[model samples]
Target: VQFSDSVSSLGIPLNRIGTTQGVTVSLQSCTNGVIHNSGWTDNGWCGLGSRMFFQSTGTHTIRAQVREDGFMIDQIVLSPVTYLSTAPGKLSDDATLLAARVPVLTSTVQVGIGTNPSSGSTPLSVNFTPNAKLSGGSLAAYRWVFGDGQISTQGLPSHVYQSTGTFTTTLVVTDNLGHKASNFAKITVNNPVTKPGTLTDTFSSGSLDHSKWLASNEPAPGSISGVNYGSFVPGNVDLSKGMLCLRLQQQQGSSGVMSVGGQIQSVVPYSYGTYEWIMRTSSTSSTPNGSGSRVSGQVSSGFTFINNSQTEIDYEIEGGHPDTVWMTNWTTVNAKQYTSATLTAPDAGFYSYKFVWTPGRIDFYLDGVFVSTHTVNIPSASAYILVNHWGTNNSKWGGTATVGVERFLYISRFTYTPL
Candidate 1:
């Protein structure tokens, strides 16, 4: 049995008239879906609602029950109490079997680019249509739940979705009877933001392209098609399968090789938009002077007022360690110097790499973790896509002479968006 009490009733007392029967009660407050308070209370695994939010002068339902052996004791006596806004005697003089009715409401929620919740990391908001009780009444309130296990106890819920994909959302409501009506909303989150026009490279099975990547390496002739790549099967990228890849086989080219990567480009140009893409690479070649002869890729992502030099960024996996990856950002059209970051990883596992390019801001990521960011104002310019295997020409990366016995820099896929 359940009863309604004053909104300010801190806690209501319930009676279960059985000594051996185990009783259980669950008090669910209107929330988004996160379990803050236990909602259960007892001396031993049945009483846990000592600190839930409750207002005064409002009706609440108290459910009482007796459990014999994990099952409810139907014949057991359950007594519950309730409080009301007005006197019970005057509920309605002509009312015979009064049933509580709430207002009918139409609700609508919105997400930025797409509807699926699982696509890319981005900001999203939810709004509801007008909601009011039938003519003389008003809706008590509305509550929402994020499939990721969060609760928003309000009429409208706003949130930044995590990652990308489709998710099922729930909206629950409570009226004066402690009665509830729930509705579900389907949402999909996708990164509709386009990528940098000059950035080239597709993910593969430990390599980029079908071993068709064009690279330059005289000191170490860069090989294209090999087995040690990221994608060994076609269509490995999607919601279910594998990730993108970029591979580079230790090259044994001529004495001084230049450009050494396979390039990919965007279909359109973006002046001051945010650009994003997830990348994975490992530096396990352990070759000599490997740092100078980078297994690197570059691009020009965004532009601004003084942004004259094309925005250039790099993903370099040198030959020295074959297990560490270095990322670099250049002031393509603004600042003249270049900024870079070096990170280590778990030997043979895949990690996510992200780059966000804006007018005065250039950010870098390693497996979604922010490592470095820059701010430089510059004018936009025509950018080109380029990837290379320049063998040890600059001392900035001078370490190994060769990129070890590795073959092919496999590339899986590329994505772009502003978050």
Candidate 2:
């Protein structure tokens, strides 16, 4: 988007990053290609622990190539329009309430808004879409700030509302034309307000690393069950930093009576404990088409947690179901499998899973809260930790899925040192 060939500036963002730090910038010819030169440099913006830079200016056709392993550039637009000021639409008393995964406060009265250059009583309120993801809407062009007693360019921003009485807020906005406007969205920012976890758990050497936890593979199926377990994958399970990364590769064929794709177990398996794992699952196997006898990946076979006490406590997270997580614990009398919890979209991003076992009850947690819990210790036998990413008999666990091929659980930190 070249505005003026003589002098123009483009706003490009780093979409993704490769393993390397350096990125390459290229200039191509475009229809409006009458420029002296075009190139890109670091703009100096960082997000999610990623370091990136922007170019000073751009025109014609510009492309950025990352020299390193995991660098990706997104929205490399060549334009002359830069963000001058944002549209400070209706503000709120507080905006942070709607931003948290689990809102600490349940009331909408606490959301606040402030002006850019707060002057007087500004209308700091905003209208939002249904279910109000926050207190504001995308009505404004540039931004609809819920200010932080400071100036910000982002829209629908959240702030650390005051703890005592209501706070005086002023809402402000700047249009793309560099024109500025101001308003006051008032409400009370009182106590019981929460902000992003700004304070890391103060380290005193006792704080453990997030990559130290362990994970295991599933148990081998039996002959009577016709379950084959020859895919003994060593080095597939790893514990580092503080996470349990599980990666299993089951060969394509079965080993006759022995079977293929063996089930590996976790080195540290206990009945009663809290466990968290961030898993990314994908398979080299083909996805099942809806035509014939379908074949999905063995996501269930990808990762499994068993009761080390033999009570048959199991948390079988499979890609077979995709959205739902199946959990079951064995009963002392019968070793029948049961469904524990089935959730939605269980195969994306980082998930922190937890399992808690007591004398007669067992529980499972995803992210943080307990999704489902099973009462009565089943099996009554000794079990171990297992994480096996394998293929089923003709069609592995689901047969048509690929996320089960290489499964990894990135455990950040487990606070089993219960107080």
| The candidate that achieves the highest TM-score relative to the unseen native structure | 2
What CA root-mean-square deviation does each model show from the true structure?
22.3, 27.8
Give lDDT tens digits, candidate 2, residues 178-279.
444445554443333221121121112332233332322334442223343434444554443334444444433343333234334434334344434444
Candidate 1 per-residue C-alpha lDDT over 89-159 given as tens digits, one digit per residue, 9 for 90 to 100? 22122223324543334333312221222223245554433233332233566677767677777665566
In model 1, the runs with Cα more than 4 Å from the true position are: 1-261, 267-271, 282-309, 320-328, 332-334, 337-342, 377-379, 382-390, 393-398
lDDT of 1 at 396: 37
TM per candidate comes to 0.33, 0.36
Clash counts per candidate, in order, are 117, 93
lDDT of model 1 at residue 126? 42
Count of clashes in candidate 2: 93
